[model samples]
Target: MQRTFKSKIGILTHILLLITIILLFYSMWIKSIVFLVIMLIINVLFVPSFIHTEYIFNNNMLYIKSGYLPVIKIKLDTISEIISHPKKNSLFTTNPTKRYALSSDQIILYCKDNRRIAISPYDKEGFIRETIKCNPDIKISE
Candidate 1:
């Protein structure tokens, strides 16, 4: 069984996208080559990425995808624990984690090798349920 989950786009990202587009049009109207180039780069590289981020679960593997970036693949069985609503920038937490989430609230997947990956799916509960269905032995932290 294969399932696809879209990442939750945060308000900040939407605001940034709006600003970028406004500036892009403004730059074009004024014929400013420098601003146009900068806006184009941001629009091409950053905006699409946040808007199109998604996670795919298929055949015991989870694939994380964003615009233009390479896909991240993880084995479902390798996940050891899942942390919901992790505290951000806590001084006590020194553990390094890779984040693919666009929102502030995220789910963290801890793998067998101590690798941590953060993600934010639109349906957090459903994502957890599906993940548990795939890997029953995985631990969950509220």
Candidate 2:
């Protein structure tokens, strides 16, 4: 069975992003209509990921998707541990690991090969449970 968990995005975050985009387009329009239109088109194309980011657990794989960003696939067997971070902080950090998170409340999946990826799912507990089902030996840390 395949399970999908939506990303946890706050209302304040959405409002801020929307306002920023609108302000940017408005400034662009004041300078050049063509540039404004092009930016608008690009933003429209990339907006879906912001509104509907999700994580999918299908069989032995975990898929992380955000906007027009490339999908990240992690095999269940390769995940060695899961660490949950339920705090408020900057979403885009200078951390070396790949992050598919919109909010600070996220889980870091530590893989056997030493690769780490962070993701934020709405149902943190359920996501962990589903992952454990696929790879029973995976460890969990708070």
lDDT string, candidate 1, 1-142, tens digits: 8999999988877888899999999999999999999999989998778788999999999999988888989999999999887776631252433678887668888899877888889999999999999999999997
Question: Please, what is the TM-score per model?
Answer: 0.90, 0.79
For candidate 2, lDDT tens digit of each residue in 26-114? 86869987767776776676567678689998878988888877888989999998887633453344254487766667788889987
Which residue pairs come into collision in candidate 1? Answer: none
Off by over 4 Å in 2: 28-31, 34-38, 86-97
Backbone clash pairs for candidate 2 read 49-67
Q: After superposition, how far is residue 65 of candidate 1 from its true place, in Å?
A: 0.6
Off by over 4 Å in 1: 90-97
Per-model lDDT: 0.87, 0.79
Candidate 1 global lDDT = 0.87
